[model samples]
Target: MKKIIEIKDFTKSFGSQTAVDNLSFDVYEGDIFAFLGSNGSGKTTTIRCLLDIYTPDSGTLHLFGRPYEFSMSKDIGYLPEERGIYTRSRVIDLFVYFGNLRGISTKDALDNAHQYLERVGLIEHKDKQVSQLSSGMQQKVQVGLALQHHPRLLLLDEPFKGLDPLNRQLFIEMFKELKEQGVTIVYSTHVIDEAQRLTDRLVIINDGKRKAYGTTEEVRKTHGSEHIHLEFTGKFPKRSELYTSVSTTKTAEIIPNKGVDPEEILQELLASDLRIISFRIDLPSLNEVFIALSKDE
Candidate 1:
């Protein structure tokens, strides 16, 4: 696949403080590349520099195989973490204004906005003022505005923030639809669970530095996390042999301190006359990996 975005040694500093330190990664065309970081971990700063909102003190960023520019930005859609809308503007008017700014004609913008509103199940609120809409409704509207111009690349910063469970599900469904249509998405979020569900690849950052960058499977493998949940009859096997930590009960979870093939571990447990009721090699959840990485940091 062609490269959609690339950042090389991208660094940014504010006076004595550094926000992004030598961060580098590539986003492939048609991939949902997730930017995972905690608060103040430089996720936003990195995105700002990538979007040309902040000029980096050092390093380079290229989009679509060339240097980024204002004209290139026209082909991009951004939904920032900080949501904003004209509080008094009518819903239809707000979408039209934003879409028109992105080169859609006023009439077409309104028509498309109405379509999006209907799709998002907010068509009944079209004539309402922005302030009249609930927080979730407003968020969906902001997303509609960003998408109104039908850009190929979307930069979403915490798109699920402030959304209820139902609304969050709606956004997830929408993202899946967009991804199926080959839209390149750069999703930034502190919510690792959501990222894990949507992303094909993930870049994790901490303390203004890259902690991990690769496919989700690669990262988990590099971290050496064996997500094997084991069930044994009688007493649990000698904890030291299987792993340093093995939770005992109906299902014993063996998390080794070193690399041990889960199959081998299971075989050993069974060979030792340990009645194996059930065993499974569960992949490590992103949230679990995040916690482990954060603790290591």
Candidate 2:
């Protein structure tokens, strides 16, 4: 895939506190890249540098093959972690206002506002004041505003925050639709489950550093972890020697040490006196990997 955004040795600091330190990564075109990190892990700061909201103390950021600056802002849509609106403003009115700020004409902005309201299933509430909508509805409105201008790239910071399951599903469906239309997206979140489902590639950040990056499978492999789930019918058998390569033999489930064949281990179990009724081998979820890495810190 073509590269759309590149951060080369980017570093930023506020006083003596370093928010981002020598971060480097590439966002490929047409990718739903998940930016995973805990609070204060430099997610927002890196995004600010990418958007030129803050001039980095060092390094460079390229957006769409050019140096990043506020000039490129119109080509990108951003949904900040904090959701805000003029409470007294009508839903459609707010959309129109924000769209116009994004360079859409008033007439066309209002038309697209209504269209996006309907698209997000908020058409019935278009005439209502922003304060009249529930918190969830307000969040959806922010998303609608972000999409109003048909931006080439979308930067969503904690988009799923404060959403119920149904609304979260709605956002996921909308992201899938956006991906289908070839929109490159950078989604930042601390929620691992949502990231795992919505993203094909991910960059895991911690302490202002890149902890892991790549396709989900590739990241898992590089961390020397696998999803190996095993359930024995009877009492769990004693630890096996061959399983130690990737596993902590103390537990039934194994973490591969050197990509050992789990089937070979199973075969040895069957040959031994251990009785087994059930077994399963599944990939470790992102949450598991995240926890493992965090513990290593």
lDDT of 1 by residue, 19-120 (tens): 999989999988999999899999888888888889999998888988777777557888888878898999998887777677778888888887898898
**Alpha carbon deviation, residue 57, candidate 1 (Å):** 0.7
Compute the lDDT of residue 124 as modeled in candidate 1.
98
lDDT of 2 by residue, 190-293 (tens): 99988888898999888788888999777767875554566544444455455542323333665544656778777866876656656677677788787777
The 10-residue segment of model 2 with minimum total lDDT is 242-251
Which candidate leads the pack in lDDT? 1
Q: Rate the local accuracy (lDDT) of all candidates.
A: 0.83, 0.81
Q: What's model 2's overall lDDT? A: 0.81
Q: List runs of model 1 lying over 4 Å from the truth.
A: 231-238, 246-248, 257-264, 267-277
Model 1: colliding residue pairs:
none
